[model samples]
Structure formats: structure tokens, C-alpha cells
Target: MKRKLLKFLNRMVLSIVIVVAAIALIVVLFVQFSPQFGGKASKEAIESYKNSKNYKDGVFKNTKDVKLDMSLKDMGKALMGFFKSQPNTKPEHDLPSTKIDSLNIANYKGDTRLVWFGHSTFLLQTQGKTILIDPMLSSVPAPHPTLGSKRFSQELPITIEQLPKIDAVLISHDHYDHLDYESIKALKDKVGHFYMPLGVGAHLLEWKVDKNKITELDWWEETTFNDFKFVCTPAQHFSGRGLSDRAKTLWSSWVIQSKNDNIFFSGDSGYADHFKTIGEKYGPFDFAMIECGQYNEMWPDIHMFPEETVQAGLDVNAKKVMPIHWGAFKLAMHTWTDPVERFIKASKKEKINVIVPKIGDLIYINSLEENEGYKFWFEGLD
Candidate 1:
């Protein structure tokens, strides 16, 4: 009887081991072989990262140590919080948007004209060049449709296919919400150059973008397109598209310097000293587009509160500030309008200039009109 029992126990253990091994193999195959998760950092890329000040021990690190409130208790609270949805998390009616007239926008010879397509997507035409920044125009921000937040707006101002010949596409990071797969695939043929932070070009390469069109930069690295100089400045954030590979790529804010205008795009950053450092290095910007949405107190070090967004704009010495990263997706627990409302109040207190344009509204950088300031477009929506 004892021998028979031992044989049964060994069989059970072997079966369990086989099952676990199969599951592990499946996950590895999915992460390594799947094109949706993007490509891993190549050996050449790894060697290049070895020389970067931010990369160490096979991962990228922020200048300041950031500890998220990920304690077991905090995570439990966060999980519970997801079950309780806030009122007005999404707009009651379809959000308003103006369809893009590409020829008129492209041909208009004037100061920089910016058209916001909700969230961080912006089309900026300046110096006779058209640039798209963080162009995540997909309906959902995720690897799969079943897995992520759906966009608040039903239709985009312009489809990627309808876009004019893009001079460059500036990618902030590889987050699914920012560096979307479908958008990149549609834009590959239309774009002249792809500018992004280090380790991000791997994704473009995997997507079959022309290697010659891709320019990857480390922090403070500057590259020029015609007369426009783009400097990859630091940001307080993290990156990952899968369970593994966290922080394998770098995240950054960008400072675009033109002959007469300086524009700063604070790409999904938290409140940190990097804001002050960037301000000191590239201050008195004519316009600053800062992130001001999808924030939670639990992850304070990753995303900034609306108040901090305004403060960051001030820190960067922005002559005029406009908040992005909201109005597209309900990625947080707060009301959909909370970010802009809070940001407007803070800007008022700090005596900072802010442009609150509606989605798809064209903004002329050289001219600041009263109609552009504090348009409570989201008001009265249930």
C-alpha cells in the first residue's frame, strides 16, 4: 500500500510540473514572439544604453528614486476603488470636434498652428513643417480592444490616412496609450522622420518603419529638422508594454526651438525637479503643452495632479500654457472635467496664462485672443 501511494504522489507532482511549465512557455512565447508587445531592446541597443547615464543594471532609471504606493494594502484599496465609478467619468454627450481641412491647414503660411486631437495628440505646423506629437488616435489605448480604456470622443478630428505629409512624428514613450500600433502603421508611409527617446526605435523597427527615418535620443540630446531644434528633455515617468520589460525604454519631454518660438511638450510626467532643470535650461517658452490628467494619489510619482501641471508650466517659464492628456479617455477615477477645471483654477491663482481650447480647435501661437482663454466647454454636461 505504501509503495502504491508513493507512485501516485509522484505522478501527481509530475503532472503539476508539466502544467506549470506549459503556462510559462506560453507566456514567454507571447512576450517574445508577439509583434503587439513590440521588440525587445537589441544587443546593439543594449550596448548603446550601457553608455547612457540613465540606464543601469539592464533597466532605465529616473534621476530621482520614485516609490509608488504599491504596498499590499494600498493595492487592495486601489483594486476596490476601481469598482466604484465616479459620476461624469465620461461626457454625457458626444464630445465636440472639428474635422481637419488638411490643405487649408497645410497651406496657411503663418505662425505655428496647433490642432489638438484630444489627449496628447497634437498637430503643429510651424517653419513650413507639419509635426505630430504623441499621435495615439486609436479608439482604444491598449494592445487589444478588450483590454484597455476606450476613448471619450467617438471620432477623431482627422484620420491618420487623411493627414498631410508629416515632417516628423515625436513619440514620448512606448506606452500603449501614447505609442499606438495602428497609428504608427498608418503613419509609416506618410512620415519623413520619427523622433523618440532611446530604446523606443526598437518598436518602430519591429513595426517595419524605415531605419533611416528613425532618430533616437538620450536625455538632453538635441536633433534638428530643418531649422527646428528638438531637445529630448527628462520626464518623471516609467515605461512598459508587458508584464516584463519595465523601464527598458526611456521617457522624455521635448523642447522644440524655432527661430522665434520655443514650445515645450511635457509628455506624461509627474511633479519633479526635472521640471525646474528643464525650465532653467530652456525657459521662457512661448507655449507649453503639459499633461494634466489621469492622475491618482496612489501613483503620485508617475502622474502629476492638475495643480502640479500648472506649477510645472510656471516652472518651465511658459508664456502660455495649455493642458493636454485629458478629454480623450477616462483613465482615472476623477470626473472627466476635473483636470481642466482644477488646472484653470490653479493657473488663475498663479497668474499664469493658459489656453483652454476645445478639441480640434486651431490655435495660433503668435496671437493670443480672449476667446482662447478658459473656455468652459465641458460645463453643463451631465
Candidate 2:
């Protein structure tokens, strides 16, 4: 009996060793090959960006030291706290079961029309031109198919193959969620131009996007395409897809100015004084689409809380604001609907105009009241 028990214990220990070894091998392989893994920034470009007195004198220098109040461990505890506090709450919405073409894409009549494609992606049509912002039409926001967040929308409003002739593509940064590899490869031959923040163009170039068609701009620098002026403005954010390359490239928000209207696209940012500076320089934005989700106290310096999003709108001097970066993925520990609900309440208190459109709904700010209040597409879930 003793001999038999010893043999069984040896087998059990060997099985455990084998399992551990397999897991370590998988992790190492993922780290080595994932696009989310490290890719070096151009040394020349990095030095130039870092040495720029304009950027040095700007808000980035001071905000780098702002420590987060929470950490990953704290986030895990917060998640438990949230679950305990809201025991009856279901975090995910029962996404509306609707066909892709059920909603019609409206033609903009002088005013801008925006179609939310989930997360930070949008289809913007104005002045007879169409622009795609961060065209991340993929099902996952990570390099591997099984590793990242999945879409909340039951179906994409329009598939990449069904897109109209895209005039230009604007990318805020090179994170996997925003600058997806599959989407870029698919749209490579279709888009007319690619506008990105400095050092981001390197990724596009690596992906075979035409160098001449790619325009990289620093903060406050402006470029013109098809009569529209795009200014790469500062945002309180960092960039990296891997552990090693954090802050190697710049992230930004954009101010798009046309002949008669202006729009601000807060690509992704944390709370900072740069918003006020942007408003002072480019005040009275007709409509602003700002990030309002995927926030946690752990990284509040790079992602704003819900109340801060409202303040960001006011800081940018926007006439009307739409909350974005939510309703798509569960990147943080908060309830899925927390960002929108908090934004709605805070906007009302702040007297800020907030437009909450459905996944495929097109919102025209000039005639927003004519359209009914934003229907809570996620209503029936919890």
C-alpha cells in the first residue's frame, strides 16, 4: 500500500510540472510575437519629440508625475466591491437584435453627421466628405483573437466591406484598440489619406500604408485635406502596446475646422488643463465627441472619470457633447452602464448639452432636438 501511494504522488507532481511548463511556454510565445508586444519607435523622431521646447513647455511635462490613486490590485478589490454593492445588477446590456442595414446612414445637409461604430470609432460625414476615425471594425481589441475585449454591439452598423469611399482616416494613437492591424490592412488600398500623431505614422508605414499619404503632426500643428483643417492637439495620455514602449509615441485629440463649423474629437485623454488651453485657442466647438469610458481610479491620470468628462466638454467650450469610449468593451471594473448614466446626470447638473446616440444611430447636432432624446439602447439588460 505504501509503495502504491508513493507512485501516485510522483505522477501527480509530474503532471503539475508539465502544466506549468506549458503555460510558461505559451506566455513567452505570446510576448515574443504579439503586435501588442514591443516595437521600437524611431530614435530620431523620439528625440525630436522629446526635445521640442513647445512640448516640454506644455502640460505633458508636469502631468507625468501625477500618480494614480489606485492600482491593479485595488481595481480587483473595487470590482468585488461593485459586485457586492450591486448584487442584482447585470453589467452587460442585452444588445438590440437588429440587422446592420436596419438603420439608414443619413446624408449630412451642411451639418455634420456621426455614426458610432462602437468604442472610439466613428463615421463622420460633413460638407460632402466622409471620414473614418480609428476604424477598428474588428471583433476583438487585442492582437490575438481570444485575448481581448469583445464588441457590445450585436452587429456592426456597417461592415468594412460595405463602407462608402473613405476620404481619410484619422488615428489618435497606436494602441491595439484604436489602430487595429486587421482593419488597417483591410482599408489600406481604400482610404485616401491617413492622419496620425507623430511616431504613429511609423506603424502605418510598417504596415505598408503609402508614406506620402500619411501625415504625422505634432501638438498644435495643423494639416489640410479636402478643405478641412485638422489640428493635432494635446491630450493627457500615454501610449504603448507592450511593457517596454510606454510613452514612446504621442497620443492626441483633434480639432477639425471647416469653413462654417468646428468639431472636436477627444481621441483619448485623462483630466488635464490642456482642455482649457484648447478651448481658449479653439473655442466654441459646434459638437465634441469625448472619451467617457474605460476609466478606473488606478489610472485616472490617463483616463478621466465620468464627472471629469463633463468638465472636459465645458473646458473645450463645446456647444454640445457626446459621450464615447463606453458601451463597447469592459476594460475597467465599473458597471457597463456607469459611464453613460453618470454622464447624463452630470451633464444635466452642469447644463451641458449631451447627445447619446445608439450604436448605429446618426446624430446631427444642428437638429438634435428634432430627433428624440437618445434612446437607451441598453435599457432591458439590467
Candidate 3:
């Protein structure tokens, strides 16, 4: 009997080993072949980034020491919270959205009009140029469609097919939510140029974006497209799409300046002195899209809360601000409307102008005053 038991135990152990090895092989193959995981920086791309002050020890660094990992206790809390059925993490039903006409974009002459496409994605029309910022338009933000939750709003303001040809797409970092593979694949042929921080062009190159069309920049680096000067500025954020690639690519905020107007796009950031510095260098912005959601006390140094979003606007000397990084995904524990509700409450205290547009509503930058009195669009929704 003892001999029989020993033989059975050995077989069980071997079976377990085989199962584990198969799982490991599957993961390796997926990462290798999946287009959604995106491309990494080639040796040449890494070599070109060697001179950047922020690129050190073979990875990008933030200006200040920021926490990129969570503590064990916080991790436990996050894991437990994930399965605890927290209420209101997402909207109860499909939210409202407006659709735009393709004809309007083809014949566009605008004073820097902006449209918020749910989360951080925006369609900016300025000086006859249509640019997309952090265009992660796919339903699920995960590497695979089955790996993530669908966005709260089931519809987009405009489908990718309906979009007029794009002049450029500006990326701030390589986080899956901000940089999506499917979105880029759909847009690569339609876009003229792609601007991003250092080391991000490799992903585009792998996705078949022409190398000539990709321009990568380090912090404070500036490039021009048509009537605008695109400056890659600093942000207090870490980046990666996978477990191992953290900080391999740089993250940044952006300054878009035309001869007549200036705008700021805070890709993703924690509150830091960089905002004030950006304001000093490219202050007095006509408008700013400030990140204001997916924030938590667990990882406080990476994303900003609502009050901090308001202050960042003031720090950047923005005349009018639109709170973004919310209105779509349930990335944190906060309620669906928490970011905007808190942002408006805080903005009133500072008397900072807030531009709250329904998803897809047009924002004319030349006259922001006309954009006010937007109804609290999320109040009635569950």
C-alpha cells in the first residue's frame, strides 16, 4: 500500500509540473505574438535615449522620488476591494454622448475647438489641424479584449472610420489606457505624424507606423507641426503596459502652442512643482486638460485627486480647465462622478474657470466663456 501511494504522489507532482510549464509557455507566446502588448524600445531606440538626463540606469526616472509600487497591506486591500462588490464604481447604464459629422471636420476653420471623447482622448481642431491626444478608443483597455472591463459609456462620439483624416496623434506615456494597440492600428494609415516621449516610437514602428512619421522627444523637447509647436514637457508619472517594462519609456505632459493660443495636456501626473515650472515657461494657457481621476491613496504620487487637479490648473496659469481622465473607466474606488463633483467644488473655492462639456460637445478655445453653464450632466444617472 505504501509503495502504491508513493507512485501516485509522484505522478501527481509530474502532472502539476507539466501544467505549470504549459501556462508559462502560453504567456510567453502571447507576449511575443500579440499586437496588443505593443512593441518595446529597440537597442537603437534605447541608445538614442542615452543622453537624456531623465534616462538613467537604463530606465526613465521621474523628477521627484515617486512610488511606483504598492505596499503589501495596500495590495491586500486592493485585492480584497476588487472582489468586494463596491457600488457605483461604474455607471449603472449606458451614458449619453453626441456624434459629430465628418463633413464638419473636412471643412474646419476653428479657434482651437476641443471635444472630450469619454476619457483622456480628445479631438482638437486648430488652424485646420485635427489632432488626437492619447487616443485609446477601444472598448477594453487591457492587452486582450477578455482581460478587462468595458468602458462605462458604450458609444463614442465618433467612430474611427468616421473620423476625418488626422494630422497628428500625441501620446504622453505607454500605459495601455493611454496608448492602445488596436486604436493605433486603426489610425496609423490615417494620421500624418505621431508625437510622443522618448522610447515610445518603437511601439509605433512595430505597429507599422512609418518611421519618418514618428518623432520622439525627451523632456522639454519641442517639435513643430504646421501652425503649432509641440513641446514634450515633464510629468510625475511612471509608465509600462506589462509587468516587466516599467519605466522603459518616458512619460510627459504636453504644451501645444499656436501663434495665437496656448494649451496644456497633462497626460497623467501627480501634483508636483513641474506644473508651476510649466506655467512659468508656457503659462497663461488659454485652456488646459487636467487629469482628475483613477487616483487613490495607495498610489498617491502617480495620479491626482480632484482638488489637486484644480490646483494644477492654477499652477499652470490656465484661464479655463477641463477635468479629464474620468467619465469612462472605473480605474479606482471612487464613484463615477466623484472626480467632476469634487473638481467643481474645489474650483469654486479657487474661482478657477471650469469647462465641463458633455462627451463630444464642441469647445471653442477662442471664447471659453460661452462654454460655461453646462448642466451637471451626471447628476440624474445612477
Candidate 4:
């Protein structure tokens, strides 16, 4: 009887070992083969990054010290916080939005017009060019579909299949929310070009994007395509798509100048002097889209509060501003409508011209007089 029992115990141990090995193999394969994780910078790209002042010690550094987490213990706590149920983090109902008329967009030949698709995504039509800014239209903004929640709205302004051929796609960084793999895969063949901060081109190259279609720039770098000038400017932010690749790429804001309009996009940034610096250099913009959501005291050094959003708009010398980062995702613990609410109040106090438009509404950058009629669209949806 003792011999039989020993034999059975040995068989059980072997079975356990096999199961563990299988799980390990599955994990390794997923990490290695998944396209959503994005690509890392190649050795050649690393060599080029060495020339950048911001790239040091094998990572990109923010202009100021940023505390993403206090330590391993704090990171653990933050992880726990994310999993815990929080009230009012998301809207109780589907948010309001308008549908994009493809024919209207294709035929648009008037002044520069923009349609916000929420959470930093915009269709910028100007000078017969249709550019997409941070076009993250995926349902879940994570490395995998199961890793994140669905967007606030069940529908988008336009489906990928219906989107018109894009003149260019501008990416601020490689964060899953701002740069989505699914969206890019759908857009790669249709987009005329992809422009981004330095090192981000590595991911595009990994995704098999044609090298000729990609343009990467360092901070303060300027490139002109079809007479429209694109400038990559500094922002107080850190970037990484995975644990091992933290800060391997750069993050930044952008300045878009066309023949008749100047636009600024504050891609994710903390309240810092970079705003003032950018203002001094490219002050008095015709329009600016400032980030105004997804903030917490723990990571205060990276994201701006709504009050800071207004200040950022002012610092950039924007004649008019629209809050862009709050409408689509519940990335923070605050109520979904909190960002715009606070932002609107601050703007009124400062006497700043702010356009609070419904998502997908085509907004003329210089039509401040007409934008005054837009109502507080999110009033009852919370």
C-alpha cells in the first residue's frame, strides 16, 4: 500500500509541473508575438537617440523630475487602487456625439476645420489636407482587448472603414491610449504619412509601416510637409509601452502652422515652464487643444488638472481653447465630467474664449463668434 501511494504522489507532481510549464510557455509566446505590445527601438535607433540631450542613461528624461510611483510598494498600491471599484469614474449613459459626414469632409475647402473624436483624437482638415491627431479609436486602450474598459461611447464619429484617406497621422507618444495598434493597422495603408517624436518610428517600423512614410523628430525639431509646418515641442511626461521599455521613446506637444492658421496640441503634460517657453516661441495661436483630464495627485508631475489646462492654453497664447482629453476615457478616479466642468469655470474667470463643442462637430478654428452658441453638452449625461 505504501509503495502504491508513493507512485501516485509522483505522478501528481509530474502533472503539476507540466501544467506550470504550459502556462509559462503561453505567457512567453503572447509577449513575444502580440502586435499590440508594439515594437522596441532598434540598435540603430538607440545610437541615434544618443545624440539627443533628453536621452541619457539608456532612457529619455523629462525636463523636470517626475515621480511616476514612489517605489515598488507604491506601485503595488497603485495597482490595487486601479482594481478597486470607484464611483462616478465613468458616465452612466452613452455620451452625446455627432456622425462625421465623409462627403462633407472630402469636399471641405474652407478654413481649417476640426472634429474631435474624444480623448485627444481629432480630424484636422485644412488646406485640402485631412490629418488625424492621436487617432486612438480602439474600444479598449490597452495592450489587449481584455486589459481595459470600453470607451464611454458605444459608437464613434466614423468607423475605420468609412474614414477618408488621411493626409498624415501625428502621434505624441506610444502610450496605449494615445497610440493604438488596431487603429494604426486599419489606417496604415490609408494614411499618407506618420509623424511622431524620435524613437517612435521604431514601433512603426516594427508594425511594417513603410519607412518612407514615417518621420520622427526630436524636441524643437521642425518639418514641413506640403507647406504645413509641424513642430515637436517639449512636454513634462514619461513614456513606455511595457515594463522593460520605460521611457525608451519620447513624449511631446505639437505646433501645427499652415498658411492661414496656427494650432497647438498639448499632448499629455504636467504644469511646467515648457508651456511658457512654447508660448514665448509660438505665442498667440489661433486655436489650442489642451489636455484636461486623467489626473491624480500621485502622478501630479505628469498630467495637468483642469485649472492647469486653462493656464496652459493661456500660456500658449491661444485666442481660443477647447478641452480635449476628458470626453472619451475614464482614465482617472474623478467623475467623467469633472475636467470640463472645472475647465469651463476657470476659463470664464480668465475671460478666455473657450469652445465646448459636441463630439464630432466640425469646428472652425477662427469662428469664435459662432462657437459661443455651443451649450454645455455633458450637463445631464453624468
Give the winner by TM-score.
Answer: 3
Off by over 4 Å in 1: 1-33
Residue ranges of candidate 4 with Cα displaced over 4 Å: 1-25, 370-374
Alpha-carbon RMSD to native, per candidate: 3.4, 4.0, 1.6, 2.7
lDDT at position 152, candidate 3: 84
Instruction: Give the TM-score (vs. native) of candidate 3.
Output: 0.96
In every candidate, how many clashes are there? 0, 0, 0, 0
Q: lDDT tens digits, residues 1-382, model 1?
A: 9999999999999999999999999878877776778877789889989999999999999999987438998888777765676578888778988887768766866788899999999999998889999989899888778677688888888877778799899999999889998999999999999999999999999999999999999999999899999999999999989887899999999999999889999998889989888999988899999999999888899999999998999899999999989999877788889999999998888888899888888899889864367779788866
Per-residue accuracy of model 4 over 1-382 as CA lDDT, tens digit each: 9999999999999999999999989877887888877888878889999999999999999987887766777677667767888777888888889998778887888888998988999999999899999989998889887878779997888988888789999999999889998899889999999999988888888888999999999999999989899999999988888757889999999999988999999999999999989999987899999999999877888999999999999899989999988888877778888898899888888988899888888798776683482488888776
Q: What is the lDDT of residue 107 in candidate 2?
A: 38
Between 1 and 2, whose lDDT is larger? 1
lDDT per residue (tens digit) for residues 58-172 in model 2: 2123245656346678867866754455432334544553334412433344567778877799888888888999888888888787876577765787888777568899999
* TM-scores for candidates 1 onward, in order: 0.92, 0.85, 0.96, 0.93
lDDT of 3 by residue, 1-382 (tens): 9999999999999999999999999988988888876788888878888899998889999998888889899999977766678888888998898888988887898677988888899999988889999999999889987777688888898888888899999999998889999899999999999999998987888899899999999999998898899999999999887767889999999999998889999999999999999999999999999999999999899999999999999999999999999988877888889999999999998998898888888888777673383579888898
Worst 10 residues of 2 by lDDT: 53-62
> Residue 239 in candidate 3 has what lDDT?
86
Worst 10 residues of 3 by lDDT: 366-375
Give the lowest summed-lDDT range of ten residues in model 4. 365-374
Model 1 pairs in collision: none
